[model samples]
Target: MPPSLRVSQRRLRPGSRVAIVSPSFGAPGLFPHVHDLAMQRLQSELQLIPVEYSTTRQVGATPRERAADLNAAFSDASIEAIMATIGGDDQITVLPFLDSDMIAKNPKPFFGYSDNTNLLNYLWNLGISSYHGGSTMAHVARPGGLHPLSTSSLCAALFSGGDFELYPVSEFSEDEQNWNDAAWSDPNGPPPSPLQTSAGWHWHQPDRVITGPSWGGNLEILDWNLAANRWIRNNPADYSGCVLLLETSEEMPSAAYVFRTLRNAGERGLLAQFPAVLIARPKASNIEIQPTPEQRMQYRQEQREAILKAFAYYNPDTMIVFDVDFGHTDPQWILPYGGMITVNGPQRQIIAHFG
Candidate 1:
């Protein structure tokens, strides 16, 4: 488990062919208009020819059907990269059908996050490095257009091949666009969630620099992995030097739930492995569960406090970074799974090695 193996090449030229799959939730299948526009942007904006497999747009496809598409994408010599359309809950179910040897042999770049965390972790154990962000539905097909921050971060990961700094942006989105309505494409979708005044990244126990390959994702998904006893290493030593990247999604689990999830990991002796942790800003409100501004602020504050309490009881010395805009938040940064991250506490800088 977690062996030291050479990673695949990251030097993909513009116009290189890429494959898009729906290994998780098939937003492309549900919203073909959004999917088509995203493909068009991949070609026109990124100058990449985006190809789809059989299950890419098939909403009713089974887990095996989706896994087949993933296998085909990775095995295809014509495809330089593979990306997920959106994320859903059942990616872990698709994992059993995955051909690890086939994926390890092919070793192409895979991009996604959220429930895609399942696949990312699977790839990690196989010695495959992947991009932790850049889902086609979320960033590429965003309402106003592809975000400059996302596009830039993705390009650095795709081409530059090493050592990229992920800077915090001044503005971020707290609301999501209504895909059911045509307004996202009609150029009138609430002006991209209104640019809120950003307060920047919050630091905890920032007394020393910690640099290492990154691991972990949507905390709930990791909890699912732990429960399933799949992909994760049996021994805790495998994660000894990795930085933990944890975040919650739109599901907005309560602060207590977040604490308990980590507490469970701590109980397993897994939380103490990392010298540092990066927690994304908690997405407090969803369309179904709308919270007032005050409530939203309180939700995040409580979640942050919960994490600190858990860490204090587990890995109290770990350097904790909070409210990083990487998870179920707007204008997210594309991080690398199993790639290197350098956290300089003295300079207060966080850098990612995309390659």
Candidate 2:
């Protein structure tokens, strides 16, 4: 591991307090019932207390206001950790307002994904490790209770500190409930989107093993960061030996867009820095964009090919794993950003170290 990268050893006990802040869109404000359910689960399921901030449910809060909430969370001694209510597109705007020095001095495990990738990468550049997964509103407040796999991996990331082996789930779904529909708040509301059987993980160049700190997040967000040259290291070698964590969002970007985004990274001399990459199962169908089953399968295939094409151009020797359940996918695994991950290609296994 690089000396610059720092992993927190602080683990949450049952009674610890976790601050829930909305550093992005205030989804909690829009769906307080779902957000309340998530808060309740934080106590009933995890046996931990959830503390919300001023902007936690404040829709249309400015970027500075969001940053203020985050800063407060970091500075508060009683708060052992911080978790976002949900992710939004404008989190990048909040980045410049963050108090990096203060956050670096008071590092804690941050848990959120999608647009939260902006904050995750910010913390990474400061050498602080965080968890990459969906927000409380999106995951914990899931209509049909939490997915067993999500709970299993989240527990590992939150309370346990060890090498937890990543597992392949039998079934998964990308469907989301319409929050505006009152049924979503009903106990007997419609069941979650139909579950599809997983084909399991696909491995490429499984001839060697690579263990390193994981980086990267939603592909689109990474592209945004790259375009802005925000917190990314100027010298790509700073990422040498790191495992790249890649995933798409609910937007369902085309294979061409995925290829171009990665191509941009490769053009920046970025892709060659990593020896291994873990691509999350792309979210094929969403509430807005519903495609046929065959189309969904075809989408994933073309996406995989696009990724391989990018790697083939920049780093052909890279070990690649596709459809690891993380990011936008349900039954997701919470990966440690900037923490150690072992990509055992020959063993066809992955182990994430939640330090």
Candidate 3:
């Protein structure tokens, strides 16, 4: 695909109906209180009506139902765009059921991340562009309150056009603030935490400005794609000049595991194709294993070394930026898959130029 192919942005007028579907897992009605609040915010704040599907709130529905809902949303002239409720495991199952022709004929903005990586890649393969950030149940329907940064980024993604610059949001929260909690409906929560000072974009080869159509998603999920051979190009050279964006999920795999995955990419001759890679901030905390501040910092450092080692062995010229606020983090920035991204390594600046 050409790095400069422009996907026309949809102008969302007031009362525009946006279909809400669960292509992965269903958690919206499970936490109806929070889901309803998010719906209200979308209608009132953004002036977009939320259109729900039958299986959208039903957990354990067949992948066919999920795929059907996706087709229905795209086919309906009344529905202008599609947004996922949240990400879940096993979205790969829905792949076989999707109609690529239908999606191609009715290309509209599709948004989600994590497991939704499967669908996003599928859309890209069909020559349609999709956004990789924010979900209804997870980001918009947080228990305590919606993050202002999340709302702002999502709005721009849904309604805006032209060149937009993304910066790190000042405050971020990754804790699981429950929508089921009674106190959450209070419309207020604790004050936003202060954002820590960031060590800005880091560069590897500082001589060039690489521009390409963006690709990639949650690192672990891409592993699953490798096994399934769903949307990946058979030849690594086909990905040449593309900016690769990656992130780790809350699963928090060990640094060794991360290295092994990178090694697999190298073995497949996939590492040398991209001129630049944007690493999303790893989600370090989980209910199963909560590490101390010192341990968390060590984890990030070790992961960084692993990435550097793999790059050195395979693609020494690839530029890298660590800990970008995307993927499984609060105040996540929206990224366009198969859209133009410019990485100026010498100046240490990264800019995503979307349609």
Window of ten residues with lowest summed lDDT in model 3: 188-197
lDDT of 3 by residue, 17-49 (tens): 999999998877576666676788778777989
Q: Which is the better candidate, 2 or 3, if ranked by lDDT?
A: 2
Clashing residue pairs in candidate 2 are none
Off by over 4 Å in 3: 1-8, 143-145, 169-171, 188-198
What is the number of backbone collisions in each predicted candidate, taken in the order shown? 0, 0, 0
Please tell me which model should have the higher lDDT, number 1 or number 3: 1
Error of 1 at 77 (Å): 1.0
Regions of model 1 farther than 4 Å from truth: 187-190
Select the stronger candidate by TM-score from 2 and 3.
Answer: 2
The per-residue C-alpha lDDT of model 3 at residue 90 equals: 84
Comparison by lDDT, 1 against 2, better one: 2
lDDT (tens digit, per residue) of candidate 1 on 1-355: 3467445675889889999999988778778888887888888889998999998988878999999999888888999999899999999999899888999898988899999999999988998888898999887887788888888889988887678777767878777767787665663233577567677899998999998889999999999999999888989989998999998989999999999999999999898898999999888877687777789889999999999999999899999888888988888899988988998888888998875
Q: Which ten residues in a row have the lowest lDDT in candidate 1?
A: 182-191
Clashing pairs in 3: none
Model 3 per-residue lDDT at 35:
68
State the TM-score for model 3: 0.93
Instruction: Please give the distance, in angstroms, between residue 237's alpha carbon in candidate 2 and its true position after superposition.
Output: 0.2
Q: For this target, which candidate reaches the highest lDDT against the unseen true structure?
A: 2
> What's each prediction's TM-score?
0.97, 0.97, 0.93
Model 2: per-residue Cα lDDT at residue 297? 96
